[model samples]
Target: MMRSNAAILVCVLAGSFVMAQEPDTKTLFKEFGRSVKSDDITLSFVLLNNRTVDVLFQAPGKYAVRARANQSTTFYVQGMPEKDMVVDTKFFVEQDGHTYEASSLNIKNFDGNTVTKGTRVDGMIQLGTKLDLTHPFTVRGSHGSVEFVLSPEALKLAEPAPAAAPPPE
Candidate 1:
């Protein structure tokens, strides 16, 4: 009985993925992505939520940094170094007069030896503070920072999905 129930649950989850009819999946992310030039690096950020963001690093060339989490879930960046650069900085966000920092950062994929260029890593920082997207926010790093003011379209985006719990009054 338990096995059959689990199977049904899996089917329901799988069906959600298969049921996505929107060809432009990027629409969900378009509202949360933004970029700026910070010193030599052109940093971009995508806000997945208050605590989550994706970051990207690019060099002299133009690259589309998709918003999802890896640091673009990670935001996107342009102007990565000509050669590979080491990931040596921390990331943070300043919102509503508070500064929140990244608990962990994964970059320069850790190989057996040194980190390789374009190496991907995963580490998310979630704190007790809930993100209030109504106000403008900033993503800061050792390199520089990016400021983002949510747009009117973001009103719907600001609200959590229906399944999420209600915010504290």
Candidate 2:
């Protein structure tokens, strides 16, 4: 009788495992990318390590990204500032044919001269902006690919900034 019970338990556990492994990366990203183009795109989800965060260009130089998390759960808000400089810098969307210069962005508490020291060996960009919850971003790095997701709302929060300069002669 005991042997029979043990076999039943093993089968049950195996069935549950099969059910757990759902949503392959390719399928997940395809759905996520489509949502971004929707009129109302508000999302909040977590990701695990080594997952692929791929962004396919929809328009000329315009990109739509589907970033998968690496081994942890991170938050996303549209227009919100990115905490990890290297990860945040990756999203340099070139709109309207003008190459947006990174140097032109003035973030609070950031000394432009010292910013380079903070660049990750993998080339993460440092960005400072008002914490706009409406535009929250989630791009976590793990394994080879970092997952990137954009929030639908337009989140906002003020950042510390440098003092304005005096008029030149």
Candidate 3:
């Protein structure tokens, strides 16, 4: 009985040590939405391993996502009900072995149903980088500001690789 107890304790300790060495990779998924008059606007996102990000936007029953060749992506939202609305957006991304900020995105809604947009840049900043799903950002409009964060257990989708050039004939 004593031997069995000792073995069990050792195994538990070893397992804990091994788990500590592993990277803290958390998946995230989140959604935010609101109704304006008869229109509805929503934003959803999924992030994995700080490597991949997928964002979906819905406005007045219309849904769309932003995708690109490189790590950077841009998305636009239209059909807002309030004119003279100001939209503020911010986010972060890793680039050139460093992190950079893509913030202070203020959009003026001249028309009541103007289009607003956001962007995420990940790798090479000059060319643009992927979105940093780890950090939280805010989208402020006439109604109010909606904050977005990564959800636990988010899908882990690998980024698509760039197409290779054809070999010389």
Candidate 4:
């Protein structure tokens, strides 16, 4: 009887494992990055921890971010309901017929634990936080956090300050 019970328990656990929902972190991150770079705009995302709001990015920059509890959406205008709290910023890139944007930060697994890439010369970067775009950086937030940024090249065009009106009207 004990043997049969053990077998049944093993089978149940195996079944659960097979049915479990596990996110593909690598693919998700890559996709996020690609999307950001493909579009020249800043986007926003909501961090979710334990099925509750963790943090909110006023505006997600231009890149991509994938964490355990985060999702993102992009919009072109305002007055629309906040879908996941999307915000547009002055950061983004356009290339190969697509636009890419910045993310608040990029976090990934490092040394068997999650680590933010602070600022790097040839790696990902955190979205909203400022950094040298030519250089690279990444940020990790509590629960789940990710934002996008614009490449320096794209930022120049994306951010078009109106010409000063001759000092005064």
Compare the candidates by lDDT and give the number of the best one. Answer: 1
- Can you write out model 3's per-residue Cα lDDT over 46-76, one digit (the tens) per residue? 3222233232223432221223323343323
TM-score of each: 0.51, 0.22, 0.30, 0.22
Q: Which portions of model 3 miss their true places by more than 4 Å?
A: 1-70, 80-129, 141-143, 155-169
lDDT of each: 0.49, 0.29, 0.36, 0.31
Q: After superposition, how far is residue 103 of candidate 2 from its true place, in Å?
A: 13
- Model 4, 1-169: lDDT tens per residue? 9999999999899778754633244422332343221122222232122211111222242212223223332222111112222222233433334444544222322112222333111223223323333333322222222444545533342232345358454
lDDT of 1 at 66: 22
Q: What residue pairs are clashing in model 3?
A: 27-154, 28-151, 28-154, 29-151, 71-130, 121-129, 121-130, 122-129, 122-130, 123-129
What number of clashing residue pairs does each candidate have, in the order they appear?
22, 26, 10, 40
* Model 4 alpha-carbon miss at residue 32, Å: 2.7
Indicate the worst ten consecutive residues by lDDT in candidate 2.
153-162
Between 1 and 4, whose TM-score is larger? 1
lDDT of 1 by residue, 1-169 (tens): 9999999999898788755632233654567766655444444455554222212234331122222331222343333432355543466778888888654433433212333444443323333354566788787776577777777766565443345457679
Which residue runs of candidate 1 sit more than 4 Å off their true CA positions? 1-24, 37-43, 49-81, 105-128, 163-169
Q: Taking the tens digit of each residue's C-alpha lDDT, what string does model 2 give over 13-88?
A: 9778755644455654443332121122222222211222322223432222222122122222222212332223
Name the 10 consecutive residues with the lowest summed lDDT in model 3.
118-127
